[model samples]
Target: MNTNDSKLREQIAYFGRSMFERGLTAGSSGNISVRLDDGWLMTPTNCCLGNLDPADISRLTRSGVLVSGKAPSKEFFLHEAFLDRRPTDRAVVHLHSTYATAVSCLPDVDPRNVLPPLTPYSIMRFGKVALTPYHRPGDKRLGDEISIVAAEHRAVLLANHGPIVAAKDLESAVYAAEELEETAKLFLLLQGQRPRLLTPEQVAELERVFGEKEDDRAKTCC
Candidate 1:
């Protein structure tokens, strides 16, 4: 394999282990993908993120054709939809984060503002976390729902499912995904405690100064 493909494979393996170790995902429950110099590299269907083999990663053409390796994850439509809707997206990570999924189960959670402005890290890494409605795993309906919110959100929590995060690269995508879980964990900790949340003005200012450049964070590049 070419050096580029090898490196991308290593990245998938590395991030896969990190995600699995961090409890962001369990079993074979998460998927990841990154834009490549030629097209893209994605984790194979049913592959455990913690044990992915570089030679086993699914390769897709820029036009979405399956070029080599095993079949791509059935939920690939979700990734493709993000890239199609957001020209700047370079990587996609979908995970069944515990706290985020728990919050999604709340009947009153606002889809447009899933996470409160609890910390500057959340504001800078994720402008707004959209709460997408429930869809069966591998269902394309979820992709459609994400399309509607992609215009404004870099990360979204799938109701009764998980969170989907996008970034300029694999590391960034994973970082944002972790940030989502951590912030969600914080939200749960403050539940009913009415912990003071960042005001609209503060959130706005943080977004203005740090949001635009968040993709440049050391961990996020493709």
Candidate 2:
């Protein structure tokens, strides 16, 4: 492997293990992918994130052909949806993290923005997380839904499923995914007990200052 590819392989394994150990995802319940100059590197299907070996991570050509390593996750198009829509995004992380999945299953939460703005980090990292109506696992149409929303949002919650996050790089994607989960945990914890949420003005100010560009605020407003 080239030096850059070698480093990415190690990083992917490290973060995958960390996510597994911290219960961000349970056995074989999550997948991660990173865009490469040549193509992409993705976690294999039905493989425990905690047990990933760098050499076994699947590599794909720019045209989506498998080039090396194990088979790619069945949700390959989900990752592709985000990367194709957002050219700046270099990594995607999808996880069935406990609290976030719980939030997805809620009946009253706004599908337009699944998590409430309990903290600035969540807003900064995720913007507004769009919710895609539930689709059967391995459904290719799910990618179409994700592409529509991901064009304007960096993160999205799949109804009755989990959260998929895209970011500038793998570490940022991982951090944003963790932040989404923590915010979801807080959202559930404070349920029925009115928690002080960041006002719309506060959220707007955060987006103005920390968002990728001024136009991002306009494009991402729900």
Best by lDDT: 2
Model 2 lowest lDDT segment of ten: 213-222
lDDT of 1 by residue, 3-93 (tens): 8888988999998998898888999888998887678888889888888888889999886688988888888889888877878878999
Per residue, candidate 2 scores C-alpha lDDT tens digits across 27-127 of: 89999999998899999999999999999999999877898999999999999988999998899999999998998888877777778889988887777
Runs of candidate 2 with Cα error greater than 4 angstroms are 213-222
RMSD of 1: 2.3
Candidate 1 has a TM-score of 0.94
Q: Worst lDDT window (10 residues) for model 1?
A: 213-222
All candidates' lDDT scores?
A: 0.85, 0.89
List the candidate 1 regions with Cα displacement exceeding 4 Å: 219-222
What TM-score does prediction 2 earn? 0.94
Query: Which pairs of residues collide in model 2?
Result: none
